[model samples]
Target chain A: EPEVTQTPSHQVTQMGQEVILRCVPISNHLYFYWYRQILGQKVEFLVSFYNNEISEKSEIFDDQFSVERPDGSNFTLKIRSTKLEDSAMYFCASSDQYNQPQHFGDGTRLSIL
Target chain B: EDKVVQSPLSLVVHEGDTVTLNCSYEVTNFRSLLWYKQEKKAPTFLFMLTSSGIEKKSGRLSSILDKKELFSILNITATQTGDSAVYLCAVYISSGSARQLTFGSGTQLTVLP
Candidate 1:
């Protein structure tokens, strides 16, 4: 069903280290998004990208967070400095248009030590 | 800030029983409401409701939205063990040309055989 795919299902890194989470959205999708879910918490939006630029971001997506579509098929989220609070399941989603339903990936479990 | 609230943090039901999940939201410029089922990982899209009084059905699952009431409900009839999963409700809000989703804490459903 042409689903979004994320790499490194599990990631463990030191508190001060940098981490990059990778996603390959549906080939024909247009809008991309990043969301994270802290254990037992509601999923929170991080950022949304379209037309090769960030269209929206939440407060949680602060200076340490950045997203880029380095190539046509890949979307990446990088955290400059990891923190204990940053540990969560990061999910990637994509939609064909603004009004379409977004499809989510299995998610990357990021654990900061 | 937009908020989504889901009721009955968890539920346990026997096979063949019927279950209904609830979701309500408060947001400006409401765009749509979506329901997803999360098993071990990714959230699989179940239904997307935009207009009121319209019921979307798939197999034994059905969902409806009440835009006027700012709520939605998902019903699973004759449930099975496979229906055990966390049901997430999310609302899309439009901001200028951008939009993002705000998710509820999700209802955990466990179907016993």
Candidate 2:
């Protein structure tokens, strides 16, 4: 089965540094999303992208967060001035159309110290 | 805010046993409900339930959605050690031509031999 894939399985960063998490969604997918799971917490939706624009975002996706689809397949999330609370597993997901089951990537573990 | 609630945050079952995981949601204009299995890194897609009373099944796993009651259940029969993982339930809701997901805290299932 074709699956979503994320780069740099793990990332270690210091507070106030910048980080970029990359994902290559399934080739034919049209909608992309980013979610985060804090240790011992529920997975929370961060943002969803479609047609090169952010369609929806949560409070956690504040000023410091940005997402880009630089190319056909590459979707990335950048975090500027990371805080200690930013440490969590960031997941990328994609779906072919609306109301479809989304496919998820093996998450990128972001660790901020 | 859309909310998803999963009951019995953890479960333990012996090999060949059966288990059921529950999920309930409160949202507007529900689109679909999904079940995923998370081992350590990624949450693999399991099933998607859209219409109520219609069951979706794969091998030993089955899921059904109850729109009238705003709930769903995932059943695993003859569980194996490999089934030890966190089972996540998520709901997709449509909002003025946009849709987003809300996830519940997963149920950690440990199927021992």
TM-score of each: 0.99, 0.98
TM-score of 2: 0.98
Ten-residue stretch with the least lDDT total in model 1 chain B: B93-102
DockQ of each: 0.92, 0.84
The CA lDDT at A18 in model 2 is: 99
- Model 1, range B35-65, lDDT digits (tens) per residue? 9999999999999999999999999999999
lDDT (tens digit, per residue) of candidate 2 on A1-113: 89999998999999999999999999999999999999999999999999999998989999999999998889999998999999999999999996788899999999999
Interface RMSD of each: 0.6, 0.9
Off by over 4 Å in 2: none
Residues B23-96, model 2: lDDT tens digits: 99998778999999999898999998989999999999999999999999999999999999999999998876
lDDT for predicted candidate 2 compared with the true structure: 0.94
